[model samples]
Target: MSDRQAYSGMAVTGIDAKGRAAIPAFLRAALDRNGAESRVIIAESANAPCLIGFDPAYLEANRAKYGSRADARLDAGETVDANAARLAFALNDIASYDSSGRFVLPPFPAMKAGLDKTGPVLFAGLGDTFEIWNPELLEADAKVHPAFKERALFCLSQWKKGGKG
Candidate 1:
């Protein structure tokens, strides 16, 4: 297998009343450049209040490992596809952006998470998955768990210091 790739920085966004959020133009451009704009997966995270997004490439890897082998007999192996599918479909909703560069989140969960309208959200890029966070929730999480800031800052500083290539 090939080595995993590193993802870029977190993009900050603002949610509108209509549950529409505008992703960063640079990110959109990057996705376009990488040919990943049209296919992406969005789902709720296991440990955070944030919603997570995954590129199709990443999802396929996941499928190959855990989602693609369900048809085998139970004696042979178990498939996590059903649960993964439920989690992805129920908690995480996949979306595609229109030409205008807007994605409308489902209103129920957005409202439940206080992402209802006019809130800042953080979009963090993970290799195969990206996470969305309400800015305040992120801030609160940082406050409660100082390691996040410590680790993030340490990593950021490493990049700044040319410690990372």
Candidate 2:
């Protein structure tokens, strides 16, 4: 990713009364440049306590890992596609940005992530995608996550070194 395109900072934003939050201009530009303007997917994060929001192009590009777990289930001889469906749609929500470049989070996805009208949120950039977090959850993570600063520094060092880290 180019310096301008790289998602590397945090933006503490809030949900409006209409259930929308402005995606930082940097992220919005990157998404538009990558042709991800059509849809934004919001869902409960499988890896953390927060929510993750990313465009479909990223999803499509990482299909083997992000888009499908059905193959594994089939190999395990699962009787139905319940697990696969759960993996795919358990927190799945399809959204679109408004005229102001703000994404609309539906009720289910918003509530699942503990975001409601007037909730405090954090927009954390994770390179290819970004994560939307509840401030409380983010603070909780910071307290318990021992290597947060070291990991952050390491990423900066790697970025400076021109390694795709």
On a 0 to 1 TM-score scale, where does candidate 2 land against the true structure?
0.70
Give a tens-digit lDDT track for model 1, residues 91-138. 655678766557887665666555777756666666555666675676
lDDT of 2 by residue, 1-165 (tens): 243255556555557888888776666777677676656777787777677877776666555664345566667885554665567665577788865578787787678777876755666778877788766665566453655434444543453465522
Error of 1 at 37 (Å): 4.3
Best by lDDT: 2
Q: Candidate 2: deviation at residue 108, Å?
A: 1.2
Model 2 gets an lDDT of 0.66
Candidate 1 wrong stretches, greater than 4 Å:
1-6, 37-39, 68-81, 88-90, 142-165
lDDT accuracy of residue 159 in candidate 1: 38
lDDT of each: 0.60, 0.66
Candidate 1, overall lDDT? 0.60
The lowest-lDDT stretch of 10 consecutive residues in candidate 2 is 156-165
TM-scores for every predicted model: 0.67, 0.70
